[model samples]
Target: MTATVAAPDKTRRLVFPFTAIVGQAEMKLALLLNVIDPKIGGVMIMGDRGTGKSTTIRALADLLPEIDVVAGDPFNSDPQDPELMSDEIREQIAQDLPITITQKKVPMVDLPLGATEDRVCGTIDIEKALSEGVKAFEPGLLAKANRGILYVDEVNLLDDHLVDVLLDSAASGWNTVEREGISIRHPARFVLVGSGNPEEGELRPQLLDRFGMHAEIHTVKEPNLRVQIVEQRAAFDQEPQLFSQKYQQEQIELQEQLIQAQKVLPEVYLDYELRLKISQVCSELDVDGLRGDIVTNRAAKALAAFEYRAVVTVDDIRRVITLCLRHRLRKDPLESIDSGYKVQKVFDRVFGLES
Candidate 1:
């Protein structure tokens, strides 16, 4: 919980540092874990206004190490991974053509509230394809978001159909757009982060369940913390470069930590008993699908990896289970128990952690 700041780059717009942001630990942790392992799916964050949701997310994107992409590629195609490469890049490889590699900051795409299906998913230019005898496709937000973070602010207000399309692409890791019998497919893998105020209305449980984790944040209740957050923001605004330099070392350390965690994630191990108990909690809670269990396991392993541990512990599961399963729980009109509390209660019983 050290206060860390991003190094000031005179050429780039300044963002409030990730570690420098005060409070909202759950939101921050969920985002970090997603970064460590995008296959855990994405995070759905519900919080009040002015909760620093957008700021924290942007800071995280800025905090990440730059990625190697094929030079001049529109999809931000990974130079080494064929699965992450665009069709053009892959075709070049097939033809044994030279490929240039370039480094770029991780892409962060914001899905605007009024975006159309074509805008979010991109469109196939059938006229150009038929006339030129080539599959001419115009990439959209999803294409730009590949191998990055796709953020949707006020996601609950988004059209349900659009949400479905986003979730599908996120889950499948590819987007296929078709028009006039011409189909275009490309990598669309990203850590989907959605934040909205609860008062705006909630995503349908079916759709909500698709997210890997759900984090709920509230306004800081302590007066001192609130004052501190306000002061930090003011200071950041007053002399952004000077303020950022203060915590630049911490930011670099955190960035290295994240990169190391990603490298270590594959070696992290989850115990069989812990896995059983995780599913037991999911089953006992009557969670609809295997996503809850799968996400909890992945999240726990990611947490262990982040802590530089090769083995997952009960504490790791304890830390992430609520975020992994709370939103997936079935809502009963008569039940007064909080979703997080209910998930924890079952976890304690199943994992034998009751005191």
Candidate 2:
């Protein structure tokens, strides 16, 4: 009898298409909205382990178009956006040196659980300093993720100090490193995506409020849908290249839609009536800070951009309330209602179901 050998896994051959993912419509929408307008801050996705949380992030990264960057730039600074460039980088350009320009995939940096402060924010280059007696800086995960996405899986399990570092950078868009009397500051702006299971632990309120949107995903409960998901996974495992090829058209269409949304985003307008409505909704929910009101308005405008609409409609505001307000809700120990439910109730009362 001949022994059957298993085929080698070709997971590297292709990534699962963003458009091909099954279910989790809300999660997908939240991600896409941020992609269209990164000023929405970022998104936190909470759910079960096997419910495509990490996969959704990888697929979204793949779905995005490549970005043009200055060659050999550690921060991936945009050639067009000088404000985001480092002082060293600016000096090179000032000398009339020919900067090599190239296109690369948008960075998707993962902050592992055991990552140290030095590893994350980078430390001085000891080798260079020892060899030449010169002070030199080393780039870290935060620098690599500039103008891209920084993803943290199982974020709630991370150490509080590290979480504080991430939150500070996310809030200020600048990562300042001071060591041995030397200081370096650079642009650290990037979209933050955090995912974890709620049962494991809870995120700090201060860190949680930094995210512009929050989404909860769950396992597919329908038998037919589960079967379909399983079958698709099996097929992809068997022939990764072939499966990706099948979804090529769909992926292209989705990418085109994202590009269109970005172009249309600036044109989309938020009217006075809708602004009043957003304020009322936030007031009714009794959310603590003004972040809720600001995020809600940004989310509504993003939805309008995605739909290629120049005006914000009531439906657009309604669609984004839960995503924007879920994490910002005040904790009520005596009331065991879902945050999304509270948002919906307030939304219905303020806008009316007919509106």
Top lDDT prediction, candidate number: 1
The clash count of every prediction, one per candidate, is 0, 0
Query: What ranges in model 2 sit over 4 Å off?
Result: 1-12, 125-134
Which digits, one per residue and each the tens of the lDDT, describe model 2 over residues 94-201? 886666666777888999999999989988876777688876888899999998889999999999899888878876788999876667888898888999999998
lDDT of each: 0.93, 0.87
TM-score of every model versus the real structure:
0.97, 0.93
TM-score of candidate 2 on Cα atoms, chains taken together: 0.93
Kindly give the stretch of ten consecutive residues in candidate 2 with the minimal lDDT sum.
1-10
User: By TM-score, who's the top model here?
Assistant: 1
User: In model 2, what are the clashing residue pairs, if there are any?
Assistant: none
lDDT of 1 by residue, 1-355 (tens): 1122333345988999888999899999999999999999999999999999999999999999988887778899987899999988888888888877767899999999999999998998888898999988889999999999999999999999999999999999999998888889999999999999999899999999999999999999999999999999999999999999998999999999999999999999998988999999999999987999899999999999999999999999999999999999888999998999999999999888789
Please list the Cα RMSD from the true structure of every candidate, rounded to 1 decimal place. Answer: 4.8, 7.3
